[model samples]
Target: MRSEPTDAERALWKLLRAKRFSGYKFKRQVPIDRYIVDFICFNHRLIIEADGSQHAENAYDEARDSYLSQQNFRMLRFWNNDILTNTEGVSEAIWTALQDETSTPSPQPLSRKGRGALEGAHNG
Candidate 1:
């Protein structure tokens, strides 16, 4: 797969390689257990799979999805046509998924009085 990437894969790689997609590092053709994923971001626990016509309703892919879900890894699949024709849409979806995985709610701010009390405690 590394030596011969499909046109769609090659196109996506241009956007995803070298932490270019939202500063998240993505490895291509990564081995996970018994399967080799097309692209994976370990930091976000996300897998991006580029599927061709042959992958339609593939039973093996269903099993793969179930297994990855059990392991807390989210998978985003895109058809070769979508990747090639609507690259922006595919990239946007990937970015949204990445944000969903990594974003955390902001902490509540301390009031002025609370800050004073904490400062006094630390100074004393």
Candidate 2:
């Protein structure tokens, strides 16, 4: 893991650290098996990644995601630009993912449609 977090990671960490986000605990720069995730909530088996342009269409990330999915860990990946520029939107998305009950111990990862459903539930 990098010794220092990026600007986006630092910003998101502020919102997630110390149970500031909905009373859920979050840790940064955590290791899970062969991969080190940006942030993780063990209670929900959730991992959040603050990604830069290097992550776009990354095959390694896809494989890593598949591995994590098999372990019943839900991943939320946000672009660095989005995290830095639209903090509220990123937080809301994270909140929706955290509120997702359907992610419980599932072998399959949460699909885009599933996330959209969650968003609809919140908006409705």
Highest TM-score: give the candidate number. 2
* Superposed Cα RMSD, model 2: 5.4
What are the models' TM-scores? 0.79, 0.82
Badly placed stretches (over 4 Å) of model 2 are 104-124
lDDT by residue for model 1 over 5-65, one digit each (tens)?
9998998889899989878999999989988899999988888877675665567777777
Worst lDDT run of 10 residues, candidate 1, spans 115-124
Q: Give the per-residue lDDT digits (tens) of candidate 2, residues 1-124.
A: 8998899889999999999999999999998889999999998888887777676556787778878887888877776666777777878888877898475432232333322223312110
- What candidate 1 gets wrong by more than 4 Å, as runs, is 102-124
| Whole-model lDDT, model 1 | 0.69
TM-score of 1: 0.79
Provide the clash count, candidate 1.
Answer: 0
Checking candidate 1 for backbone clashes, the offending pairs are none
In candidate 1 the C-alpha lDDT for residue 8 amounts to: 86
